[model samples]
Target: MKFQVIRLRTLLLSAALIAALFVFCLLGNRAILTVSGQLQQHGTPLILIDPGHGGEDGGTQSADGILEKDINLQLSKKIEALLHARGLQTQMTRGEDTLIYDAGCKRMREKKVSDIKNRMAMIEAAPDCIFLSIHQNYFSDTACCGTQVFYSPNNEKSALLADAIQKAVITAVQPENQRVIKPSGKEIYLLYHAQVPAVMVECGFLSNPEEAAKLTDEDYQNKIAAAIGDGVCNYLNNKQS
Candidate 1:
């Protein structure tokens, strides 16, 4: 009986030690997560997402008739879902397919001007917001493919966001893309006028038959948007840190 009791006592002591170590590990992990999170909020300004094109503004289309506007809206919505899951604040330029223009003139130039005004209004409303405009590229040269991130020449921080996003794009999808983050001049009206940190992302080339097909696929679109969301999250968290 004495021998049995000693064995039981030893076993109990060992179990107790194991439990205590487990608790210590759990607490240490929690502390690490907390500290890392706090460090990431380096400078979390608001974020405004612009889904390029709308209503009548059906941007570049695939030969198959898929409108770039539709693709932009879908991808932006997906990004919004991911951002919301991470507890990040985001604002989209337009949620629907409706035109930014009220009506009357349907001229391309007139409508584009009105859209620019609306986009600027959104940026002005959230002066401190980081701006992101989602778009797809189309060129006569089908060879030009892959995601390209462009920053406002006027804002230095915009370049950071562009680089961060480009890194994510290359990492997630187009690993072969050689194009780097470029500056948007007068050709991109919104980037020129945006007062906040701004970047316009060309998710892929619509002119390339294969790329166009991929962009139109719902699953592929989700992947693209998710990659973008992940990049934005990393950038914002790092900025805060």
Candidate 2:
């Protein structure tokens, strides 16, 4: 009876040791995850998302009467949510269909220029931030379609970001899309003169009837937003490595 009690005590001790080891490992993993999250929050730059055109400027319109500005804002908001879920910071240029120009500007043209300048100033102030302008494309040739990303010429980092986003969109949303990343020219006011890394994502060609329909779909917009979030995370990871 004495020998049996000793064996039972030994077994109980062994089980206790195993349980203690498991707890230690669990705490160690939690500590690592916390540290990892901190690093991610520290290293990743805030994303400045600009939903192009608003108010008087309806931007391009599809044959079905869908407005580009509305679609841009919707997609931008979706992307912002995904970024937030991934623990990344984000800022939006405009949350509603209103002009951001100074109150002094009364004329429509004056308001447009002032709004653009204000956006530029915001970009300049946030030197470490990544700028993403969401817009839809319109072409006389309805044959042209697919999402295209344009990066600022002033920054090499913009090209890398554009490529990452473009690849993500193609891979996740449209596997058949063969669109390539292009550099912004003088035509793009914000991208042409940006001091920080910037990319304008042309979500889709509104000129194409089929693409326009797809762009209006909520599910499709969500997929695009999730892909963009993945691209941003991937870019940040690569930068850290």
Candidate 3:
């Protein structure tokens, strides 16, 4: 009587628990499959976004204590999201704030060299991929502020891509920007040696107090990311036609 009722109740509870778990897992898997399908259906050739200067090397700094590495990472992430939303396949170098050097490299100089070499290897591995390196500029004259783009000199597509991105940024994000795209010099080892189209975006000058504030804002960062995404889309569309 009473004992039989308790046993039946326990069995019912266990069955309910099992059914709930099954439903949860089923829904989760379906969600993953949907996203995977979306990515595969519209994916483009890989676009590698490298957020420059990580780990111990904090590239540049502003008067207000903002670090360039942090800014680069934040902006890169935003750009990645925007590009993905537009159905573009994207990859990142050093997704976090860490130097991606070979494990055995010990000294600071050795690590820096290893980091760049490792980055170059990634670029070579995806030979057909486009590369976008995100960085901030610092000048002795704080008054100098605007977005400037540098492209690999040897690749004609690199120049076109840089020009498109610069134009997009100026028109969409910073109307006052008047900077032009230039050929990357030998100082940028990765860009100079890159076989594929490569461009480095100097987002803004951290040396300027006003521009530094805008760079740190979430809204402004999204605008910049959207502008970059538009530029990449424009370049890709133009390349196809």
Q: In order, what lDDT does every prediction score?
A: 0.82, 0.87, 0.88
Off by over 4 Å in 2: 1-42
TM-score of each: 0.79, 0.82, 0.82
Between candidates 1 and 3, the one scoring higher on TM-score is 3
Lowest lDDT 10-mer window, candidate 2?
Answer: 31-40
Q: Encode model 2's per-residue lDDT on 29-67: one tens digit a residue.
A: 443222113322336677889999988888999988999
The regions of model 1 sitting more than 4 angstroms off are: 1-42, 103-108
User: Can you give the lDDT of residue 65 in candidate 3?
Assistant: 91
Best by lDDT: 3
Candidate 3 lands at a TM-score of: 0.82
> Candidate 1, after superposition: displacement of residue 220 in Å?
1.2
**Ten consecutive residues with minimal summed lDDT in candidate 3?**
33-42
Q: For model 2, what is the alpha-carbon lDDT of residue 7?
A: 100
Rank order by lDDT, top first? Answer: 3, 2, 1
106: Cα error in model 1, Å: 5.1
Q: Every model's Cα RMSD, please?
A: 15.0, 13.4, 12.2
